[model samples]
Target: MGSLFEELEAREATARKRVEALEAEVAEVSGRLSAAREGLERLRIARETVAEVLAEMTPEKPGVAVDTDRSSAVDSVASAYAGAERHVIGVLTVPNWQPGMGAEVLPRVYRDILEVVTDARGPVRAKQIVPRIGLPAEAGKIEGTRSKLKRLVERGWLDEDTPGMFTPARRRGGASPNSR
Candidate 1:
């Protein structure tokens, strides 16, 4: 009986040590995951910044090649391709609204946002629009949504009459171009 008790105690100690090792591993993995997510977010922001800068500098003519000295020609080519197939593909930033432009030309998140504002039929705030677009009603998400709304306003896809309140930009026909 004494020997059996000692064996059981030894087994329990081994199991506890394994659990502690697993816990340590989980902590290490969680830290790595957080770092990876942060790096990914930084990359996303860098990409968006580059896209915005390129869009501003790019000429409307298709034959004009972007200056490859400042940036990769592949990005310019991809942007041109994206512009050509924008109605079918998603763009990283909102394009300058054209007369016949529709919500389909925008990315899925932007389209969802536009739809939410149009459906609201009045000015809506970022917090109000966030959950409607299937985002969690968190401060970070609300701020991100707000930034997107401001981008839409800048691109003439939406309007902000009051600070923090967004509405679809009005067309000559009293309907939003996004409605089409």
Candidate 2:
């Protein structure tokens, strides 16, 4: 009986030591995982910044060859692109609506925009359009949406009744020029 009791005590001591070692390992791994998550978050923010900068950069005469010493021109273009990128990032982080995507989500941005503009008897401004579309009243968001509205007008989907005001193109009694 004395020998058996001693064997059980030795086994309990080994088990306790294993539990302590596992606790130490768990702490180390948790610290590493936390550091990795922070690094990943930093990388994600960097990626978004690069994407915004790229979005604002445009090739001057995309496929055309430069015929002169364009150092000054290149500098100007870079500066302009940087300014545009900052402006866009400061205000709106949203992308413009793509008309080709079929209805898939509830209260779509493009459809809501049309509904807001058409529901009014006349031209609509960004002030009126912003809330209807469910975006925050940020300067960048408002201006970005306004810009999108202008493009839709150029594409024959809507008409600009006046500067910064919008109306549906169909009110003029014709199909969109680009529509099939």
Which pairs of residues have clashing backbones in candidate 2?
Answer: none
Candidate 2 residue spans exceeding 4 A from truth: 1-107, 171-180
lDDT of 2 by residue, 1-180 (tens): 999999999999999999999999999999999999989978875765564444333356342222222454355445546655442222112222235432232125656776788788889898779977887787866875786576566545567867888887653334454332
Model 1, position 172: C-alpha lDDT score? 62
lDDT of 1 by residue, 14-51 (tens): 99999999999999999999999999988886766655
Highest-scoring model, lDDT: 1
Q: Which ten residues in a row have the lowest lDDT in candidate 1?
A: 84-93
